[model samples]
Target chain A: MNILNGSAYPNNGVHLNKRHRKAKLFSMLCSLVTWLGVALLGVLLYQVSSDGFKWLDLQFLTSFPSRFPYKAGIKSALVGTLWLISMVAFIAIPIGVATALYLEELSGQGRMNRLIELNISNLAGVPSIVYGIIGLAVFVRGLALERSLVAGALTMSLLILPVIIIASREAIKSVPMSIRHAAFALGATRLQTARDHVLPASYSGILTGVILALSRAIGETAPLIMIGALTYVAFLPEGPMDSFTALPIQIYNWVSRPQQEFHQLAAGGIIVLLAVLLMMNTIAIVIRYKTERKYK
Target chain B: MTMGTFRLVKKDCINNRGTRWGESLIHCGLALCTLISIVTTFVIIAILAKESFGFFEEVSPVEFYFGTRWVPLLEPSSYGVLPLVWGTLSVTFGAALIAIPIGLASAIYLSEYASHRVRSIVKPLLELLAGIPTVVYGYFALTFITPLLKTVLPEIQVFNALSGAIVVGIMVLPMIATLSDNALRSVPDTLRQGAYALGATSYEVTTQVVVPAGLSGVMASFLLAISRAIGETMAVTLAVGATPNMSFTLLESIQTMTAYIVQISLGDTPAGGIAYQTLFAVAGFLFLITLLLNVLSQWFLNRYREVYD
Candidate 1:
């Protein structure tokens, strides 16, 4: 009986050891895969930075595009992207905030409210290319806007509207209910309480959401491409009605060309685009951090 | 004194009424905007339906569904959508295959094992991946990634689906990781504690318990990611050649449905022409697929939502 028990102890020890080894192996594999993704991202960033750094001067940024590769600049595309983002922010912020306030604060928990909420969530997931198609059929053809900056901006506004609404709703929801009740008890009306107390409290949060949404809109390429951002606009758009190119479209046009120089130009455009995106994202992060701290 | 008291009382009443009215007006205005957005959805559907119907009048629905060829620009101009659909599926499938493992693993590491400082740093870095524009991704796919692939695989085409799919997978990895992390985080800590008490390994608990419990949200993320892959335009358009051939090889060039729509849109496909109408028809199909996926995800989430007190 003693011999049998000792033999069983060794078997159990071996089994436990095997299990531990298996767990270690699994963890190591998971860590390796995660690291691989990070490595790939690093390689991509390195390639873009290295290939484009030579041409990323003030002259490359400010001058107008020329026929020759070396003389080409992204002046029009840069201005157009800025203009489009501004218009998108202008169009999206008010409506999105209003919708969020109504949904979160004013609207009763009813079927219609639920439907609206569901619709917005669903719309947020719809592939952006579908928006491009809608913009093509509705804005370009139906409204007769043609291939213009206004059309692109309008399309982008719609694309990012749901994002803004979702973010604003979260912001509005974060406001303590006790504050609303206190204002009401002090003979402050609903409108006054919401406007003065609630809106102020939520302003930073709402602004951060709006900025993030706008940043997303700025990076979008599908809808704008569908709306016909010109591939090679040599001059800046004179008006919203004028055809234009954004940075992404210009990068796409350059990359599609057969020449190595154009590829370098595409990389340069990417650096500029990344700078704008990073700046916008940083502002958003700062605002979000500040708002979170205020709430805390 | 009586007049002053009466005027003060009247002023207070008027102020209260005015505030109430203003609140009502704001609510009404917001409702009106929601109404407008809903109306816009309807309007888009109507336009797409009308145009697609016009397209169907010229071509049979059967041809659009299953016919093997897609020659919308040729003399015969067959409108078989199979090739385009096949191309779309191949690229999206390739992308999902690449994205799922990497994204899920990243989410697991971040949520289950990483320290607070590591998570704070890694999360934003992951998000930076999403912030990169699809066009830049397209550029990378076409210029950098393709050439790199060509070194090992000499048969790879200049504008192949593999490079586009890989870049798109990278672009979408953050989205998947973020959503999946949120899901995993939502799992009750008590459940994890129970697993630990049972002497299960951390990996075993994570894979068997936490991931399973969060499966619905994870599935929703995957569905959304697939929808994103399917609807991608510029990246695929720039990298995947405009050829609409139906093939499974990752090395061969392919054209997705969105790319085809973009190509025709770029050209002068006259309003009310078959080509123009075809864009709507294709879009209608795209719209239906994405809508179905979104609805299904919502349904799944609602059905399986974890109820915690």
Candidate 2:
């Protein structure tokens, strides 16, 4: 239409302006959609903080749960969470890192090796509750471990093992092939190279990954619930075999109760959970950045 | 001289019995360690097969699948799983409805528009969403979201599907956004430049060129997120109602398969009873559904995967 008239420049200007306006509006809409996640986080934090602060006190952190919300505390839950995480870390790190090392370095590309790789990825995708069922059968009944911290920790180790292995593989994979070859050229054995150079260089990456996986393990409730972690435990675990209740289970128990105070207590429990999660994530991020700088 | 040095090194490597012995031992150990995952899968399948088969023996497969009700605890129990399936699907459907568009849009913005500074800030913050415990999300739903929704929809029940679905959607948003962002970013820069050279707008370039190129990955992300929502137990157990009703209404209380598992587990059902068998049966069904979706996601990822180096 503009080509037909030699002096139709102004009309074309208006047409392009219309399109530009529509495009700008559409882009703005996309930005709004992008903010949905941030918006949800904002609301969640605000809601929890508002309800949590009033109930969050030293006493609340130190005392045991009571029928009276005013007297209830998360001492047992906090202690149990710490015990569970420590046990999980103890059980998962060595095996997870070893599996990654074998698959990435030592193992040949055999059919069996490929099978292990496929199984690990598939296991990573399996639901946590299924892991719980396995725990119920193997740990609780088959092994006769019962609903103890040891069983829960062992189950969680299984749940997070694939995650840690996958992450460690990524970390190990990032180490330059030149570094290992250089070590080999210097008469360092494969084991010596991996131990002396490769493992040291990738240690931070492995740590960050393990920390992140442990954070995920900490928040896990389903498998633990499936394995029948006690919800009303008023005492802290004294040993690995002792029965335990985690923060998530404690919060779940509280939320189910009909009392308004218990709901407040649940909110308070969330604040603690979020804080622990945030701290772990912060440490992971710091480790990741530091390692990245060193490597690069 | 170089050959002599090489021979000495080779001899040293060959003669290091301790190192050779230790290395082989370590290799065997690690290889055995890696087999744990395979054993775990076998154990899960064995347990599910054994227990679910028990359930099927007691309650016929025809009735279990075709029956409309799922009341295992009540007298004269009905084994129809449709109600539980309906409950689970409705929540999943609701979550997908809420997650897909917003997640895609967020992916587009992050991949196509956000500067590095903004991307770094926003990306981690979004991940923090995934990092928060689901139990907290459940608490948030029960306490905050439900009350907030009550203002808008006065008739909504305290334990309705809407709140659970919305929170699950939020929980899933990070997975979709992050995965889809990677997908969108994987689209070659040349494609965007080609679209721009054709005088396409930014939105058009994204929706038509980049998104189409990255469709499988985006679709894979959706599949993965749906599987996640289906298997999610705690938040749904808390926010979605526990009653095993046949109704699909978002406002009514309903129980999902995961929720039902939690219900039976929480109750003191006698060991090796029918109630116990139902837990395994429901879990087996849930496992199959999630496993199918996961395999589908992996297939899409491998089949349509693009490499632009």
| Candidate 2 residue lDDT tens string, B28-129 | 666568667666788888899999999898999899988998878787779998888888998899999999999998999999988899899899889888
Off by over 4 Å in 2: A1-18, A293-296, B1-19
Best by lDDT: 2
Residues B160-204, candidate 1, lDDT per residue (tens digit)? Answer: 989988888887888888899899989999888887666666766
TM per candidate comes to: 0.93, 0.93
| Residue range with the least summed lDDT across 10 consecutive positions in model 1 chain B | B1-10
In model 2, what lDDT does residue A83 have?
99
lDDT of each: 0.82, 0.86
